[model samples]
Target: MSVSFPVSVRRLSAVAVAAASCVGAMALPASAAGPRHDAHRDQVAIGGVHSRSDRSLNGEWVEIRNNGRGDVNLSGWTLSDSQGHTYTFRRFWLDDRSTVRVHTGFGRDSSRDLYQNLRRAVWDERDTATLRDNRGRFIDATSWGYGRNDRSDDNRSHRNDRDDHHRDGGRRH
Candidate 1:
C-alpha cells in the first residue's frame, strides 16, 4: 500500500523533524546547563604547589591564581585534597591577575596568603588537589607525583613526577 502525504504536510513534517534535531543539538548536559556553569570557572586556576615541605608544615602550600580581569570572591569556595582534606574559604576576594598561596599550617589571612590552620600536612606526594566553587561545582584540579601506571614505589623514581593540570573539560585519572 502506497500512501502519499500532500506537499504542505510533507514540508511541515520535515520542518518539525529539523526543528527537533536543532533543539537536541543545542541542548547541554545537566551539569553544564545551570548557574554551576560559571563564566569565571576557567579564569581561576591552580598554579604551582610546593607539596614537599621538609622544614615547616607551613612551608607546604598550594597556589591559586585569578587570571581574569576582575576580582573573584572566594568566600564559600573549597580547596580539597585526594585524601578528602578540605579548606573552605572565608570572606575573601582574590584580586584580578593575582596569585595566592594557601599554606597548610596556621597563619593570619591576608590578600596574598591564606591558611588552612591544620596541624599536619594535607597534600601527599602522589595526590590530586581539586578546587570547587561555592556551589560545589568543580573548577580545576592538579595532580602530582606519579601517574596511574607508576603507582608502585619502584616506578616512582623512573617517572618525572611533574604537575599535571586538569582543566574544565578533563579530569585527573
Candidate 2:
C-alpha cells in the first residue's frame, strides 16, 4: 500500500529512527564496543612518580605501567606535566605488567628508562602528570602535593579521591 505523508511527518519518523539507533548503541557496554575501549580504560596507568630531585635532572621521573596481559605499543603515547611539558614515546613497546620510567634529563634510551633530555627538572612538588594515548585520549594521571582547597585548570578533570592533592597547575616537547 502506497500512502502519501506530509514532509514534516516523514522527517519526524526519520529522526525518531536515528535517535533510537543512537540510543541502542549507547546502551551497549564499553566492553562490547571493543578492545580499543578497554585499552583506553584499564590497560595502562601512571604507576609512580619521583617529583623531587636534588642530585640531577634525571632524578625526577614518572613511571608508566602497563597493567594488561598483552604488550601495549606506546609508540605515539605522550606524558605531560601540569605545566604543559610533554614527552612523546618513540616507537616503544611496553610488555605486559611492565613499567617504564620517563626521566626528565638526558640519558641513553633503554628498555626500562627513557630520557626527556631537558636541562631543568619537569616535575614540581605539587603537580600532576597526565598520560595520553597517540590519539590524545586521556589514559591515566597521577597527582601529588595538592590540597582540597587548591585549584588548577590543567588537572581539574583528572581529580579523584586517590589523587585528590590539588593546586593551580600542557605540551612541551
Q: Which candidate is the best by TM-score?
A: 2
lDDT of each: 0.76, 0.77
Model 1 ranges with Cα > 4 A deviation? 1-37, 148-173
Looking at model 1, residue 173 earns an lDDT score of 29
Error of 2 at 78 (Å): 0.7
lDDT per residue (tens digit) for residues 1-173 in model 2? 99999999999999999999998888776547576655655888887788668888887888888888989889899988888888999999989989999999999999899999999888887878888888876677777677676443323323432223213222321
What candidate 2 gets wrong by more than 4 Å, as runs, is: 1-33, 148-173
Backbone clashes in model 2: 4
Question: Which one is best on lDDT?
Answer: 2
Tens-place lDDT digits, model 1, residues 1-173: 99998999999999999999988777756546564346567788787677757788788888889988889888899988877889999999999999999999989989999999988998788877788878876777766676556443311323211233333344322
| TM-score of model number 1 | 0.65
